[model samples]
Target: MPLLAFWESNPDEVSQTSIEQIVAMAGDGNLRDGSLCSDELRQYLTQSDTSKLASYVEHCLSNSFAKGGQVLQDLVNELGRRLDFKVANGRYQGTVNAIGFDGIWLSPEGHTIVAEVKTTDAYRIPLDTIASYRRKLLDSAEIAEPSSILVLVGRQDTGELEAQIRGSRHAWDIRVISVDSLLKLIQLKENSDDSETGRKIRSLLTPMEFTRLDSLVDVMFTTATDVEATIIHSAAEKAETSDVITSKETSTTPSGWEFTDATVLDAKRVKAIEALAKQLGTKFIKKSRALYWDSSHETRVACSVSKRYTKGSYPYWYAYHPQWDEFLGEGSRSFFVLGCMDLNFAYAIPLDILRKNLSALNTTTTERSTYWHIHLSETSNGLIALQLPKSSRQLPLDDFRVPLDQS
Candidate 1:
């Protein structure tokens, strides 16, 4: 409860500046004494001076460390307020910091948006917990008639919430939507609307995360390259456990599954990699680009998975250089290639092997590190490979390692 602790310890700080003001001050690396934040959060906030403001919002919104009911409510309230929606119902008891029940937004489209912001994993709103909201919306026939929905800002799956609502014996009202997905959708709406008002609205949106989310959706969902990559990746998966390498006798692969750059930047692949990491009982990092890291191993390895139609030639394996640079800069030494869509396998270069090779092949280090073309086709049994079967429940981490250790 660092969040709580920080607040308690820094009553003076809390009183002097608002969270946003603190964030702004932190961005300037000027967080005064008695700041209500942990060291990690302080560091992150300080770094925000160089990063986008939206980065701060995304970090706060997504991370476990920066969350609380009040925190979530503040963010949601700001989002709704900035979206120019009227709070038909809100937990804001008006004492500036006293938060209450929840918020129901009356959108510009006359739709009532119910936002349940929860940062605690231990807390899931039960059917009974939502009765007040249901009554609030239903009792007011005028508000209920206008496309009301309970958008769950949850840390986990809200499918159960949806199912519960659907199965309830009442008016078929208040559909459920994920806050992250809904956030993206709302930003998408803002992006799609090219009107002057839309432009003005975008300019006015605070914290810059709304704009950032919109741009991310625009690129990942609407951009031409991302679309092609996603399509090719999907088709390749449906076709087979992608053979990323032909019999090219690559240095990285024994089966000649050539280590090439295939950009799998979709959400599904990311989630799959994350789930696999969870099952492996290790940490997973999927953010910003085509790189995912499995720190589950003693040595963390950055990876790019294939999901494209590469035929008998090189698959469209791509390394988002910036992502790799960031990953490596974040202290990952080894790198892995995974057939995340179909084959469910990962090949790796040991840290020593990678360092030595990158040094030898390093005609241009910094420039080359920015983008990965993975040219290690020597395959002298130096590379470590991890073969992930359909079910890895019984397989220990060692089972996937090459030179298979009997121990």
Candidate 2:
């Protein structure tokens, strides 16, 4: 029968046939010599697309096999003959009709090894699943120890064979081989065409199937292993500091200011501002609720500070009443600094001198330079400084000072 015919009929049966063929081929010394089967069926299962056997096999062979089902059947038959293994189609085991591994293996040492095979992704196989298979084999009263092996056959950029043994209790050895290797072997046999056996073995090998098998193996093993440690570490480092303030907040407002009721600030906004501040080399203070540059010449700024109503509803008139009035009306004395702005200067300027200048500006109506008004609003929670117009004359002395001209 053609290999395509068996593949189209049923995946389970196709697998069994292929295993038988491989065993025979090995026995004939056409493939490789080994005392026991190399569990190639498991590898085939991992590499084969069993969901739609006909289409998968067709795809693997690039539709070269005219009769899809027959091609698979023929391949398996040839493999069995070449490996010198007895091939059986459907073997019954109690309630289950084991299509994949119904055939009995007659070892050279007179040991009969019964095997079950599946083609699937490597990572998807759970330890529990392997345990279940072990239990099923034991329950069936098949050969002792069962000698189960899992084959993970996939492709890599470069064709190279790799193997690893896995399994906890029973210790099932796993071998990972590249599909290229199998294809190469088949190619070699085909090229020789020395005998009928050679032609049959060569006909079963296809490059496309080897490529598909490679993809399956890659996905499986890659997923099964632990990866992404570097990414995790990078993310962890960034999240360590919680209280860093940022530059955006400082740039948004004028200097030496502290905000009261800062808790009202959105968490995301605060984080963004903190990040900005770090980049700008500005100072961020949680206690003062302010962002400022370390240099005395820089201005400080703060955000939020209103005495608004609490988030929830309050009693009767209290709901309509301003929270500040309500608290004060109730004889509660609470003072909050909404926000404060301070000028940071390279040279210290006395607060007394600043106050004198402020008083002179308030009293004088004579012609003066750019006049500016610095308005500060007081709230129950804190003081808030309103933004001053550019024309407003409340310029800090530091703005007017300059070092000696270099020219």
Model 2 TM-score is 0.24
On a 0 to 1 TM-score scale, where does candidate 1 land against the true structure? 0.33
Candidate 1 lDDT, tens digit per residue, 1-407? 34324434564564455454444433233333233432323333222211132343455556554233444454555455434466533543333433234676765555565556655334445645455555655666635654444545544476655565667752254455444654554454332212223323333221124435775454444434434544443343333434543333222435333333332334434454444443444444432234444322133445455543445323333332344444445554444434333334344444444443342231223421333333212123433222222222111223343221111
RMSD of 1: 17.2
What's the C-alpha lDDT at position 198 in model 2? 33
RMSD of each: 17.2, 31.1
- Per-candidate TM-scores read 0.33, 0.24
User: Per-residue alpha-carbon lDDT of model 2 for 1-407, expressed as tens digits?
Assistant: 33333343454665554333533433231222122222342233323422223334334344343233333333333232222233332222223444234334333233333332222234343444444544565578754452343332322322221211233443333323233344344333322212223323322321113445764464333333212322232232223222223333421225323222223333422443344333334433221112211222132322221122222221000001122222223322111112111211111122234334443332212121222222332233442222223434333333322122111
* Cα distance off (Å), candidate 1, residue 219: 19
Clashes of each: 15, 67
Total clashes in model 1, counting residue pairs 3 or more apart in sequence or in different chains:
15
| Lowest-sum lDDT 10-residue window in model 1 | 387-396
lDDT of 1 at 392: 24
Model 2 poorest ten-residue lDDT run: 312-321
lDDT of each: 0.41, 0.30
